[model samples]
Target: MYQYDEYDRALVFERVAQFRDQVERFQAGELSEEEFLPLRLQNGLYMQKHAYMLRVAIPYGTLGARQMRTLARIARDYDRGYGHFTTRQNIQFNWIELEQVPDILQHLAEVDMHAIQTSGNCVRNITTEAFAGVAADELIDPRPLAEILRQWSTINPEFLFLPRKFKIAICSAREDRAAIMMHDIGLYLYRDGYGQMCLRVMVGGGLGRTPILGQMIRQGLPWQHLLSYVEAILRVYNRHGRRDNKYKARIKILVKALGIEAFAREVEQEWQHIKDGPAQLTEDEFRRVAEGFEPPAYQGQGDDELEYGSHLTMDRAFARWASRNVHPHKVPGYASAILSTKPGPSAPPGDLTAEQMEAVADWSEQFGFGEIRIAHEQNLILPDVRKRDLHALWRLACEQDLGNANIGLLTDIIACPGGDFCALANAKSIPITHAIQQRFEDLDFIHDLGELSLNISGCINACGHHHIGNIGILGVDKNGSEWYQVTLGGSQGKNSALGKVIGPSFSAEEIPRVIEQIVATYCAYRELDEPFVQTVQRVGLEPFKERVYARAPEVEPCAI
Candidate 1:
């Protein structure tokens, strides 16, 4: 929600103009595909399996209703009728024409959004908790810091071409909803014992071919040095991070090679010279950024009866939806409603049509504040909805195909646009996701199972975040045939842990059954009301592995 100043506007406008010329040169045969690859990537344009994909940054996953409407317009005019909301809380249009990318960027710029830094080996979008401002348990709002980082990193000459893509996340809540531990740089903002705000900084966490949890480089860093400290870390990595091998280019690989202690020392050495420099945040700058995110005016109706129970009593379907989709808000008589785009059996996860986007925009204005949030789990959030309007909003969302009512259930899958779109994919992830959803269509059955995150990636890139799901499925190719490898016990939270692989790979045909076996094992072995993750952690992966491999003896068994 940070408003773009004249400087920000000029920067984007200049970049758009530069890219427009580049697109012209490419079309004119002056720039070959190889020559233009980095140029296009820097602008968040990727050449996919069938067409170009344009990823637009939704900074810190916050957008106003007008911005949402603009995105809907972009989807309708430039690309396909829908967009895919990604795990990083950005949105991608998978069927964009190469020539129309500049126009798309222009449209985004009009709304103070752009495709800058959404891709490439440079620092990507700075993400944070989707519920930053509104979360009841937050120690500090992270959006101001996220915005500060975004400004500092945008087209930074020193970091424009890093060894690999860098991702940073900031979280202010106790729950760690931002997956802070899995980012290249993660910041946990909290108040110190003396009531002064500070940041806990973690560096070098990422998932790809190699997944590693970030190491804490700095603890209790005063909030004033946020930008300066980040600059120091990036400067260290940009100078020394490997470039000879793409596989070893990430800061995680460097951190792993250097060891945490050495890395922390290097960052500290770098920081000592620069901590109190100009990049050190000023009180006025902080206030300016914070002002943009000032809490919207609320009626402040204390202890008002919401009359929401009537819907639960009158309609079983509504009751089921209310149980899963609605989350408690800190404010009295208010709630955060998750409008699930991951509908089962029919629609692919995170795919939303243009009309649906517009409808959601309308609903956000009507039932909530004129604001929307894109959660990292590929769901849309109306963050400040009145509890009294839940039923009406639910009905409108259901009509718009935006209401699946499965926020944390099995069918609410996180999947990448696999072979259907991504050039790097080994298999089609969407159809397989559909297959699984169709097989487990019962809402009660799914809810009863409870909070199972099934993430599928078409390849080891882990674009779907398979490494962090409760049931992680990664597609692989064996002798030109697509197969899947499963991992379990992974979670993204305050207690974040990477999942361990259960056993051998399964054929595409066998994936559903494999999943069923895994779920069945959970059902059989779980303690009272134990979630799948808790059960797996309690008994270890041995019990589930034994049952899963027993069903398919041909596949080799492996331990986590």
Candidate 2:
């Protein structure tokens, strides 16, 4: 984790004081509601249906144990006893009081964290893979570059007020765990033939009213020009992106309207002027940032495999948990273990109680380094756990209700804090999520179903990333009632694809059965050991659609 320098601390504290004054003014009738709206948004505060929600940025999803402890303290003392981890690798406190926001911001600043750029039209938190430096198959860690982008974009006068919120994600692994395809700007970092770091830039990816996978605009871009090149892309967007309609303001919309070729040309034309400017990253600058992410010192001597294998053979329960929750580590005799926040209906997906948060922090130090990571899937990861300590960690994790052995299974559903919290939500997402979790509670059945992704969003904003799930569910408003539209065959990764809608939206009551029917159809046609996504791809959505709609006459199949 990167420690904050004097400048970083000063900026955060200054912002905190500034926002505190603004909040006080608004409460005292010195500022109108409309006047306070942008001020609050710029500071990552949202007036939700019930209360204010504060979103705190966890840059690249990395956290120190001390920082985690502070977050736990805030959850325990301030709002509710828990916080919701979002798909963008951030956390939201849903029951925040308007007056206490300044205090919360102060606490975050003390921990070298803040809510800056977590909301609003400015560039948001920069994200990369959770297992960035430690992934066994990683080419290079993308965090150093991601951090560079974060610092440059934070409070940059040129981009503070873009047409719409901009999201940027970087991925360096063979697998695209960061869901780079769905971001406003996605960069893939890799080494070229001469072993020089290079980037492949993609643009126009977003999911809201319109979902489109990013198109690769530039490849073989030198790492030295990373900032300069990105500046060029954002410049093009800042100038040409639509401002008349919020619905059509995303960079994706502009890219679509102007076409990729023309957009690339625009970026290139802008880049020529700044390509060799001071913005170009130098080796010393790269090392200065990279030093923050150096790998933890390893004590194991690569001899724990036999003992770990023996434990796996001895305990079937532990074996099951290990199979699903454990990830390969680049270091020998070590592994990254995912603590599933999506345990069941008792806790909503992506939510962690304050007690659980503290426990995770303690476990991170006990089992590995005192570093924690938040996955885009909304799970906490102990990224350097020793393989030898697998059994012990499993026992402790299971006791804490964080040991659900369903990483990529059907029940590991990704969902937004829908109508329950968010005012923008069309329907209640948690209830639907709980219903589906209850319907498919059997671990054996879910494991047999194989790797599957099911994501739900309260609305088309796609906050839960419904567009990239293998099974996507979007809540829609029909007159005054809430209905859910389903999409199948969507997937994220190197072969990312936007899911296609199966048919018309279904009532809340019918969602569980609808999902069950889709799974049933998948099981019937699936080949030996075929994953649900591969099955959907091979057979298409027709069978699942036919199965879902065939028996229903009461449910009308029409556009919402």
Candidate 3:
């Protein structure tokens, strides 16, 4: 994790002080609600349904033990007992008091964390693969460049506010775990024949009312040009992006209107002016930023296989958890372990209590390095756990209700805090998440169903990233009543694709059964050991559509 230097510390503390004054002025009637809106948003504060929500950026989803402890303290002291992890690799506190925000920011600054650029119509948090530096199949570690981009974008007056919120993601792994395809600017880092780091840049990807996968604009771009190229794209977007309507303000909308070729031309033209300018990354700066991500000292016990194998053979429960939660690491004796936040119907997706956060922080230090990572899937990752410590860690995780043994299964849902907390939500997403989680409580059943993703969003804004879930559930309002809309065959990764709506929307009460029917349909038609997504792809929507709509009530179909 990157330690904050004096400059970083000063900037964060100054923002905290400025926001504290702004909050006081708004409360004292010196600033109007409209006047305070942008100021509050710039600081990662939002007015939710019942209270203020503070979104704190976990840049590239990396956190040190100290930073995790600070977040836990905030959850314990400032707001509710828990916080929600988001798809953007950020965390949100829903029950924040307006006045206490500065104190919370102060606490974050003490530990080299902040909420800056986590919200509002500007470049948001720079995210990357959770296991960036340690993934076995990684071509390059993206965190260094991700950190560079984060530093360059933070408080850059040139792009303090864009027409709409922009997100950027970088991935260097063979698998697209960070959902780079769904970001405003997605960079795939790879090495060329001579082992020179390069980037493949994609632009105009976003999910909301209008969901569009990013289109690749530049390939084989030397890594040194990353900042300049990104700036070029942002410059084009800032100059021509729609501002008259919020819905049409996303880069995706602009890209769609101008076409990919024209957008690429514009970006290329802009790049011509800044390609070799001051924004180009230098080797010295790269080394300086990468120092923060130096590999931790390892025990180097590559021969832990015998002990690990014995444990796996002895305990079926531990084996199951390991099979699901543990991921491959570049180191011979190490692995990355995912601590699931979605532990059945007990908690909303991506939520962790203050105690849970503290326990995870402790476990990160105990089982691996004193570092934690937040996955875009709303899970915490211990990125360098030794293979020998698998059983002990599993036992501790089980005690905390974090060892669910369903990493890519139906029960491991990704959902947003919909109408329950957000003013923009059309219906409550938590209940729907609970309904599906409870329906598939049987671990064997969920595992048997295989790698399936179910994502829910309260509305079309896609805070939950429903557009890319294998089975996407979106909340909708019909005739002043809340209903749920379902989409099938959506997927992320190398072949990212947006889901297609199956048919008419169903009432909230009908969602669980609807999901059950969809699962049953998949089970019935699936080939031997075929995953839910492959089955959906092979059998298409007609089969699932027939089964779902057959049982669906004869209410007039609602348009999404």
Candidate 4:
């Protein structure tokens, strides 16, 4: 919700004009496809399998109702009549024309939005917890800091073409909803003994060809040095990070090669010079950025007349949704509602139609404040809905395809646009996702299963976040045929840990059965009400691996 100032406006406008010219030249045949590749990528345009995909950045996944309406308009006017919300809390239009992208950028700039840094090998959009400001358990609101980092990194001269794309996440709560441990840089905001805000910094976390959990670099860093510290880390990575091999170019690879102790030492050596410099935040600058994200005025209303318990007594479906989708807010009467984009038996995860977008915007305005949020799990959030309107909102949402009632369930999957759209994909991920959804259509069964994140990626790029899922599935190609490798015990929470592959890969056709076997093993081994993650950690992957590969002749019984 950070508003653009004059400098911000001017920079975006100039970039739009520059891209407009570049697009015009490409259309006029003045620029070859090879020549236009990087330019188009820098502008967030990708020539995908079907058409050009435009990824528009929703900074920290916060947007007002007006901005949501504009995005709906863009989906209607230009590309297809839908958009896909991604795992990074950004939105992508899958069928955009090459020539109309400049116009799309112009439309985004009109409302202080842009697709810049949404793609290419540079620092991408900074993500934070969706329930940042309103969450009941937060040390500090992280959006202001996320916004500050966004400005500093946008078109940064030195980092424009880093070895590979960099991702940063900030979390203020203990739950780690933003998947902080899976980012290139993760900052946890906390108050020290003196009640002053400080950041605990972690670096080198990523999920790609090589997945890693970030190592702690600095603890109890004063908030004033956030930007300068980040600058030092980036400078070190830029100067010495790998560039010869694309696969090992990420900061994670560098950190692994140098070892955590040496990397921490290097960052500390670099930070000693810049920690208290001009890039360090001042009180006025912090206040200026914080001004845009101050909580909206709310009336102090009691739950006397409200039917908080009555709704649960009246409707079972509504009760289930309230339990899963609704979250505790800082305010008494208000609650944050998460709208699941991974509706069962529909399109792949995060695919939302234009009408759905408009409907969400309207719902945000009607039931809550005129604001919305995008979660990192590819879901939407109405962060300020009242408790009284919960049932009505659920009913309306059910009418639209938006309501799936599968938050934190087995069917609520995280999958990438694999062979269907992505050029680097090894297999078709959507069909596999549909297959799993169909296999797990029983809601009661899924609810009883409890809090399992199943993530699938078509390849090792790990765009679907397979490395962080409780059950991770990665697609691989064997002689032009698709096979899947399954990993278990991964989690992206307070106790973050990477998943371990169960055993040998399975044929694509056998994946659903493999998942069912794993789930069955979990059900058998788990104690009363133990989640899949907990059960897996307690019993280890041995039991699940044995059960899953029991029937497969090709599977080898080795831990990943």
Write model 1 residue lDDT over 1-560, tens digit each, in one string.
Answer: 57899999999988999999999999999999999999999999998988889999888899888988998898899877888899989999988988888888888888888998889888898898778888878778889989988998999988888988999999999899999999999999999999998999999999989999888989999999998888888988998999999999999999999999998889889999999788888889999888988877777755334477666788888888889998777787788899998877667888888899999899889987789999989999999988778888889888877777788888889999888889999987998898898878777788888788999999989999999999999989889988899999999988888999988899888888778878888887788889889999999998788877784343321111
- Kindly report which residue stretches of model 4 are placed more than 4 angstroms away from their true locations once superposed: 551-560
- Over 207-290, each residue of candidate 3 has an lDDT whose tens digit, in order, gives 999999999999999989999999999999999999999999999999999999999999999999999999988999999989
By summed lDDT, the worst window of 10 consecutive residues in model 3 runs over 551-560
The full ranking of all candidates by lDDT, starting with the best, is 2, 3, 4, 1
Q: List residue ranges in candidate 2 displaced over 4 A.
A: 551-560
Point out where model 3 deviates above 4 Å.
Answer: 551-560
Across 93-183, the per-residue lDDT of candidate 4 in tens digits comes to 9899988888898889998999999998899999999999999997789999999999899999888999899999999986889988888
Across 387-444, the per-residue lDDT of candidate 2 in tens digits comes to 9898899999999999999999989999999989889999989999999999888888
Looking at model 1, report the run of 10 residues with the lowest lDDT sum.
551-560
User: lDDT of candidate 3 vs native?
Assistant: 0.90
Estimate the TM-score of every prediction: 0.97, 0.98, 0.97, 0.97
Q: How many residue pairs clash (N, CA or C atoms closer than 3 angstroms) in each of the candidate models, in the order given? A: 0, 0, 0, 0
- Candidate 3: how large is its RMSD? 3.2
Score candidate 1 by lDDT: 0.87
The better candidate by lDDT, 1 or 4, is 4
Native-to-model Cα distance after best TM-score fit, residue 47 in candidate 3, in Å: 0.7
